[model samples]
Target: MSYFLLFVLAGFIAQLVDGAIGMAYGIINTTLLLSLGIPPVVASASIHVAEVFTTGISGLSHAFFKNIHRQLLIYLAVPGVVGAVTGAFVLAHLSERFAKTCIVIYLTLMGLFILYKAIRMKSTAKAAVTFKKSRIIPLGLLGGFFDVAAGGGWGPIVTPSLIASGIEPRYAVGSTNFAEFFVALFSTIVFILILGISVTSWQIFVGLLVGGAIAAPLSAYVARSIPRKIFTFIIAIAVILLSLRMMVKLIFF
Candidate 1:
């Protein structure tokens, strides 16, 4: 298949999952593109470009029915953007294998954490709760660091963490989507300025935007009524599957 076709397929699949779960576009897209021999930096940059449009569309759709916490967005995005920029540069010089390894390990741990949280939350019959500012900052920092390092793992980490901290699932998802807009914008610009543009990157970007736009409204509808435990379980499963896929590639391929 042509590389363009590959990118389109990757984008479609990634955005479908992303729309349903609140984040996965970068994680899935980057991993697939890297497997196709794309450099980690290029893959990361391309995903960011696509994510800008995807997240914007999804965020707007989510806003129609969800409460977005602007204050939380500001607090989280500041550190996320900084961390993403640093990660993009670091990725530019790292070996793809090493980057993949790091991503696999991180995702695995994060997936397990989310899974555990989901199980605990399920038993309680209430979403986990928290309002501590101290908790938010540190979690945001960690989410930002991983997001940049692994090419957009922040959504999975931040969304669940926020939900666990007592925020409603709909709002947490919306807030994460809102914060992602700036993160992708800043990361894309940095990558473009540093790495130069290419046809492949543009193809992936367009595909992601298109797919995300199509899925956003549908996802918003579902997000409104989906139970917190179910949502957490679904996202956790996705993270675990993606993490395992990455690890398999690292180990045997």
Candidate 2:
């Protein structure tokens, strides 16, 4: 019961960040799960599975608001699923501690990258709407791989990169969230085949589902008011702090 509430809170916060800054749902939620002693593979599988439901709500919310990029969604979905499946399968065979460390490191770097985007990069919003649909193949492949590898990345890697390259925030967030649904759905199937589903914590799964669903519409509402840089900074700080906590625990214990 206590854990259920805890995960609900985690999911709310995770989705808020993802909705606002276009990233961090998987990394944030998985960090909490890992801290609770969940195995690395189990953590990723559970997160990806839970994300399918959450992302569906998010995608719809974004779509209704016309936040998605049609071409970008096309570029991301197919390769994203392929990479997600491969990553899930590979994760199933990895050593827990090693995978945990790698995930934490990956998250830490993502946070820092967010900061770089916020502080260093100039806004390209003037031309952001007509971004060049460049490098979709390699970017989608690698983004999908790292997303499941760390239990999240499609947004962190793809969103800022697209934004920096002149894609607008709403489109980046919406399309990525939309594409994440398919990536998570397919990756979840792969995880079930490779690792089975008996290990997942249903209590936490339900908690995340409900919490994320609640946050979905709220995030879209909040996003309309907040500037993209401000949201990115908030996400960067949250992820950096959580990632440091995970790293500290691993190192000291």
Candidate 3:
């Protein structure tokens, strides 16, 4: 297949998983681009450019479906933008190898915790709990920073953290996904200033944008329709599998 069509397929599949479970869009696409010999900086910049559109559409779709927590979205997004800009600067100056390795390890532990919770919880009881500003603000900052520093960590860090803290899985996924759009946008702008917009290929940018946009609404509906127990299991499995994959790549490749 042509590279354009290849990226379109990658984007569709990645966004389908990402919109439902709240992670992997950037990890998937960036890996694919790198394997095809795109430089790390260019691949990351291109994916973020595409995400500016895909994530916006996905966020809006989640909102229309009543899946988002508006307050949570705001709390995550503002700090997330600040963190993303800082991360972009860091990316230009430092190697991401150590940061990515640390994050993958953390994701593995979180996956296990989520798996334990899925098994032990008897019912899909969602508590109407008020989130503390202290926990969420730090989480947003960390998620945003690693998202740029490690090539996509917002959902991996934020969504599972929210769910582990007793937020409903749907709301956690939706809010995190929405917050990521701002993070991606600001990070892309910083990357452009540092590395130039020409780093990204137009074909990769347009393909990922179109394909992710197509999948966004359908994925939102999937998030809304899935049973809570089943959804939790899916998220747990996805997190574990993706984390393990990253770990293998980090250690072996």
What TM-score would you give candidate 3 relative to the actual structure? 0.93
**How many times do residue backbones clash in model 2?**
0
- Per residue, candidate 2 scores C-alpha lDDT tens digits across 1-253 of 5878887888888887787667779778887888988788666656767789999898888887778878888888888888888777787676656756875776688678767777865544343566544687666776787777655567766766565554556677788888888888887777677556543677778888888998988776665556766655665676677678768978999
- Per-model TM-score on C-alpha atoms: 0.78, 0.77, 0.93
Question: RMSD per prediction, one decimal?
Answer: 3.6, 3.8, 1.9
lDDT for each of the candidates?
A: 0.72, 0.74, 0.86
Clashing pairs in 2: none
Could you tell me the TM-score of candidate 2?
A: 0.77
Candidate 1 pairs with clashing backbones: 129-166, 130-165, 130-166
The 10-residue segment with the lowest total lDDT in model 1: 122-131
10 residues in a row with least lDDT, candidate 2: 123-132
Best by lDDT: 3
Which segments of candidate 3 are over 4 A away from where they belong?
34-42, 127-129, 194-199
Candidate 3 local lDDT, 74-114, one digit each (tens): 99999999998888778867678888888888889998998
Cα lDDT of model 1 by residue, 1-253, tens digit = 8887777778767766676676677767877888889887667667777788888887787778764666676777777777777777776565657656766786788778878877877434764334666767766666666676655567767776676556766777777887778777777777668767443566666765666677777777777768778877887787788778778867898
